[model samples]
Target: MKRSERLVDFTNYLLNHPRKLTTLSFFSERYKAAKSSISEDLVIIKRIFDETEVGTVETFAGVSGGVVFTPAISDKNSQEIASEIAALMGESNRILPGGYIYLSDILGSPKNLDKIGKIIAHEYVGKQIDAIMTIATKGIPIAQAVSSILDVPFVIVRRDPKVTEGATLNVNYMSGSSSKVENMTLSKRSLAPGQRVLIVDDFMKGGGTLNGMKSLVHEFDCLLAGVAVFAEGPFKGERLISDYKSILKIDSIDVEKRSIDVTLGNIYTEEK
Candidate 1:
């Protein structure tokens, strides 16, 4: 095949398989090209990713050489998005007793969820994200919306064990916000080893759930493309994981005042 055609298909594969490494033999088999030619094309593709707002392309070297991409969204975009979501959170109807906010409206708004999903998908546009993942019930919409943008499978992690269509994997977790032990499960066949995964959720409180999801990703022996959330609560103080993005942070919610203070935090960070 022509060098141009080879590179085109090569980049496409990279975008479709984020953290996976493609050895010289794999490329050689796919494109009928020499290892050296594939390597050169990969270098060019990696450089291109570095210049875009979309994502990262990390090239692994040596015997198991392949390239992996990770999304790195800009801080400006993240802040702007947070402001939008925070404003929406201002709906008086969203208020419930004890300062808890109801997100049924946001969860049910496919159009709005589409926008949020697209914004995040744009950040990982060209990276291969095997499946978009989130916890069951609450996170299904976000995961579905994002999966729509990326055109990948949407995997749901269930809060309780139930019969699912495919294989299953269960996990035990401690929910940070509620300070309660919880369980989450995913279809065993949903994710593959070395696949790239993008984690998304509607909101984050103390990051306990995200931490549990992180553990599942690790267990799969795959790489985390990144984590993204719409709103982050004030309780997320010094969690064990890093490299996450949230549009807004809730500093305080005055139950009596019926007010929620919103600010922005690290949606963008230095990547080594």
Candidate 2:
């Protein structure tokens, strides 16, 4: 593989698997390259990430040397934990077809969304979170719930710029499945500089929307307190987010049986 391509792939692998590091020898064997070459690649990638204020690359030196990506906030420590996620995911639900699932009921129920939202807000209760963001079609209600509990503002990420909006910014992200770039937009004045934000969504399929939201937050010169998703979909191959929380992880949706399988996500245990 070309050096440039290998570097890009290496970074993607780490970003997709934060806190999971593979040794240099592993990469050396996989790429059939010298250890020195791999080391150079890691340095280049780490520098690029730090300069952009995107990610952090830490290298453990010694007999079991490896690299790990540690996000400022990890899902495992979110107000909600993974074991709790499994319990919620245990319930079955209706699946229409083509792997598409309808979750309108969950989003609309204030009580249900409230419990989940509060769990997420609890983590940022004193973090000075300025607002919550969610991408429309499905995430609006959940975002609103979290915003209410946090007593903060809420911003919606639109699929396209509406005529009524005065000014907006657009960002392109790799769709979770297709890997094709899609556009999501938000009003320019929604988030202010030096503001802290908590990103919330109804579902996290591929984290494409999360990445887009992160980019949008960056454009507004805001800081991200964290991200929380009601449910996480399968396919955890190349995720763009690191610090996040998910209540449930759907294993499978049995459309014919009207049942669904789910598991717990990262839950916060320590007192924040």
Candidate 3:
């Protein structure tokens, strides 16, 4: 194949199989090209990846070594996406009855969610994440997107127990807004002991739900790798957990005025 054609194929392959290593011999043989030629092709591909700021192509030396594609969103790209979402969140029509912002549209958009996932995954790149965990419904998309980029499994915590789950581990948590105790259950077989878990959620108010998830991680004997949220809203009471990250920080909400203040979160401001 021509070098240009081979470059296209190589780029697609690396992107499709993120985090998986493929040796130089494998690529050279697949393209019917010499190792020297394959190496040159990779150099070109790596340059493009770096220039685009989408990800990085890392090469390893030695007989057993290979190249791995690590997906990452640049700070500029992350801020642009966050700013766009903040504008979307500012829509007046999205205001709900009790000052809640209707974010179903934003969460449901594949384009938005895909970028959000990449941004969140970028934060935990160097960490060990065995699996992604989140509550059922809205959080499922965020969890799945992160898992896809990280090449890991994701587990869901359901509010209602299902017979199909077989055995379950249940926990009670206080509702952030309602101030009522609620029960959340997870399938016993979903998560194993000693795994590192990254917890994600769509929105956070009082952080009651996130706290519950942290407890669940301990109950399963797993270490908490990190906690991330798509958006966090203001609450009258103190947050249950303070060590979490958010992509968008909601400063204020007014039900009567139908307005909200949204801005980029700690990802851009936090020290690396």
Candidate 4:
């Protein structure tokens, strides 16, 4: 194949299989090219990836060394994506009763989900993450998108236990929004002891649900790597959790006026 064709194929493979190591010999053999030539092609690919701020192509040294692609989005791009989402959410028609904003359309969009995934996944790129965990239903897409980019498995936490799950672990947590106690469960086989987990959700208010997931992680003898969410709304009482990240912040909602104030969340403002 021509050099251009080889470069296109090489880039596509690395992107589709993020975090998977590929030896130079594998590419060399696949492309029917010399080792030196393959190495040179990697350099070019790495340069383009870095210049575009899409991700990083890491090259390992030694006999067993290989290349791994880590997907990332620049702060500027992250800000742009967040701002766009905030605008979409700021519309008066999106405001629902009880201080809630309509999010089904935004969360359901493939374009929005892909960009949100990249922004959140970029935060935990180099961290040791064994599995992505999220509550069942809305948070599933966000978790799945991040899982795909990180090339890691994602597990779901359900409100009720299923017999198909076999042995399960359960945790009781206070619901932030309703100020009521709630129960959540996880399959015992979903996570192993000592595995690091990242918790993600579609929306957060009072952090009751996220706190419940944190407890489940502890119950399973796993470490909590971090927490990320698509959007966060104002919590009247003290929040259950403090340390977390969000793509957009729902600053204020005027039910009477039919308006919502939205802005970029700490994920964009925090120092890298």
In candidate 3, the residue pairs with backbone N, CA or C atoms under 3 Å apart (3 or more residues apart, or in different chains) clash, namely none
What is candidate 2's lDDT per residue for 107-174, written digit by digit as tens? 67676766666566655644667888888878888788777655577999998999877699998888
- Candidate ranking under TM-score, highest first, comes to 4, 3, 1, 2
TM of each candidate vs. truth:
0.67, 0.64, 0.96, 0.97
lDDT of 4: 0.92
> Taking the tens digit of each residue's C-alpha lDDT, what string does model 4 give over 1-272?
78899999999999898888889889999999998888899899999999998799999988989999989888788888889888999999998888788899998998899999999998887898999999999999999988988889999999999999988999999998888999999999999999999999999999999999999999999999999999999878799999999999998999999999998998987775
RMSD of each: 6.8, 17.7, 1.2, 1.2
- Error in Å for residue 71 of model 4: 1.1
Model 1 local distance difference test score: 0.74
| Candidates ranked, most accurate by lDDT first | 4, 3, 1, 2
Clashing pairs in 1: 15-128, 17-128, 18-128, 167-188
lDDT score, residue 165, model 1?
Answer: 41
Report the number of the highest-lDDT candidate.
Answer: 4
Tens-digit lDDT track for model 3 on 1-272? 99999998999999998888899999999999998898899899899899998699999999998899999888888888888988999898999997888989899998888899999999998788999999999999999999999999999999999999989999999877778899989999989999999999999999999999999999899999999999988878788888999999889988888888888887777876
TM-score of candidate 3 to 2 decimals:
0.96
**Model 3 C-alpha RMSD to native:** 1.2
Ranked by TM-score, the better of candidates 1 and 4 is: 4
Model 1, residue 251: C-alpha shift (Å)? 1.7
For every model in order, what is the number of clashing pairs?
Answer: 4, 13, 0, 0
Model 1 root mean square deviation, Cα atoms: 6.8
